[model samples]
Target: MLTAYLTHPDCERHQMGADHPECPERLAALRDHLLVKGLLDCMQEHEAPAASDEQLQRVHDRAWLLQLADQVPAEGYARLDADTLINPYTLRAARRAAGAAVRAVDLVLGGQAPNAFCAVRPPGHHAQRAQGAGFCFFNNAAVGVAHALAAHGLLRVALVDFDVHHGDGSEDIFAGDERVLLCSSYQQDLYPFRDSHPPAANVVLAPLAARSGGAAMREAVTQYWLPALARFAPELIVVSAGFDAHREDDMGNLGWSEADYRWLTEQVLAQAQASAGGRIVSCLEGGYALSALARSAAAHLRVLVEA
Candidate 1:
């Protein structure tokens, strides 16, 4: 089976404004880099579908979800937060982003693919069940986790977030859900500033200090995430794969490199091979610097595809 690459053009349509770090150019840069590196040739590609109301309701509140739809403007942008907004295409793009994660899960679980990566954006992980922030509109990976648990009757699913910021939104949705284990690593001083916080019983944390290097992240993950994952023995692994922690990306100060991303992907992929029949669904989260994002995502994809 091949690794699946999922993306949508609408993802590029959901932009904040000119020169924003999370600009629409991110998808283009990533895609072009993957193409240049020949990573795209190794995977089976698919266009992301729009997530239904029923699908998104698994992780988001119905009222807030509806409000997101109602807030879409005809030509101008609508505000969910100072950093998050909805242009004419933001809602559709958000649905596509969420839907890509769900589709990746379905493809992996249904035996059509061994693993998958979603390249859609309006990057998630900051959108809580009832609120949106940090440029996130919907908790994409959380939606997928909920789908695997609720729709596929999966008893154990691990959601691993290695973004530069804590996956507080994901934690908020799955805090009390025992069937899922959420593991997160983030720079403590970045935006959202959810550093050194206590996680739920099912949530494992590996908070890295500002300017901490990859060794620190590796140590934290080894000390916390790996053991919990071994104990839980998840049936599927869902990843919030973000690259902003890279030293080149100024989104945070973790100072990681592309090799660190490859190492992280290796850990997740190895665990999937051991306990999940190689079932994995990884979704794009935060990676700001275009060059770093492209290089890091390519490095991450090489592991999943070549595995």
Candidate 2:
């Protein structure tokens, strides 16, 4: 089966501002590179549906949802935080961005696709259960993980986040849930400043020093993530695929390159094949540098498609 490519045109409409790093053009760059590399032809494409309130509530607080609805401006932008902003279409776009993750899970688990990648905008992983912050309104990967556990009856679901910054939101949601294991590697002392606290037993946090480069990341995965995943034997593997750690990207000081992304994806794919019937769902989280994001995402997708 081919990998599923899930996205929505509405994702392009949720712009924070002209100077925001999480711009709509990021999606266009990824799509353009995928097209140029002929990666799109190897996959099944689907337009993402808007996530219903029930689905969103699975990972986000009801009050937060209603607050976001109330904050949506008819024309201008409403700031959720110093970083997060909402415009007229922001809520709808956030729903579709998160919905892409849920649909990706269904597609992979239903055997319609070997795996799926969600190339949507207003990237998630920063929003926690009760609040939206750091340019994230809803935790997309967490929503999908919840769906896999509640809707699909999957007992063991693993979430792997390789974003430059720690997935505080995911960790917050799955902190004590033994059914889910979250393994993450992020730059030490980065944005949101969340490395101070100790993680739960099911949560594996690998903190890499600033400018650690790809070698450190590989070592972290081998020593920290792989062992935990092997012991957990997850029924489904979900990836919070963020490319901002690329050497060319200025989002963080990490020195990883496209090759690192390809290698990391291969490792995740091997784990999926071993324990999850090759079922994997990847959601975009970060990657501001357009050219590097495009190239790195294309590299990651090439592995997903086995191209």
Candidate 3:
């Protein structure tokens, strides 16, 4: 079966501001690049369905979810934090972005697709179980992992994050859960900077210094992530794919290029093949520079399709 590509038009409508780096144009740029590179042809496309309340509750608190729903504005934006704001369409887009991950998991585990890539915006890795932060509302990758375990009845799962910033929100929800192993590599001193001492054994936090190049990241994956993941023997693997660490992106000092994204994806694919039945659900998280985000996301998607 081909890989499934899940997205929705509403994902672009959830905007924080006109000047925000995490704008809707990132998704547009990625889609255009994928089409131009002929990467879309090898995949099966599907529109993401709105996530059900029950599915969302598996990873997020119901009270927080309702609070977000109640806070949605009729015309303007509502501030959740200093960096996170919800516009009129923000609520719908957040649900769709999260729903894309859940649907990707379903497609991969239900045998409809060999693997899946979710290309939605309002990127979710920073959103905690009870609060939204870092331009994310619902933790998409966390929601997907929960869906695989709860709905699909899969016990062993893994989440791999390669964003420039620590996925503290994801770690917050999955810490101490032995059933899932979380492997992440991010810049050492960035937003929500607290992964230096990862709180759990299941979480392999590879905190790199500023300006750390792709080689350093590769070393972390080879030394830290590979060993832990191999022992887990997960039934499925979910990726919180973020491209903001690219050299061109000013979001962080990490100089990761498109090749790094491709190499890392291939490494994850190898692990998935060995222990997870080749199942993968990748969701978009962070990437600021438009050109770099487009190219990097394309590279990641290419590996998903070919592998």
Give the count of colliding residue pairs in each prediction. Answer: 0, 0, 0
The estimated TM-scores of all candidates read 0.98, 0.98, 0.99
Which runs in model 1 stand beyond 4 Å of their true positions?
Answer: none
Cα lDDT of model 1 by residue, 173-242, tens digit: 9987899999999988677877466666998888788887999998998889999998999999999999
Worst window of 10 by summed lDDT in candidate 2:
192-201
| CA deviation > 4 Å runs, candidate 2 | none
Q: After superposition, how far is residue 44 of candidate 2 from its true place, in Å?
A: 0.6
lDDT of 2 by residue, 96-159 (tens): 9999999999998888999999999788898899988899999999999999998899999999
lDDT of 3: 0.92
lDDT at 248, model 3: 98
**Residue pairs of candidate 2 with colliding backbone atoms:** none
- What overall lDDT goes with each candidate model? 0.91, 0.92, 0.92
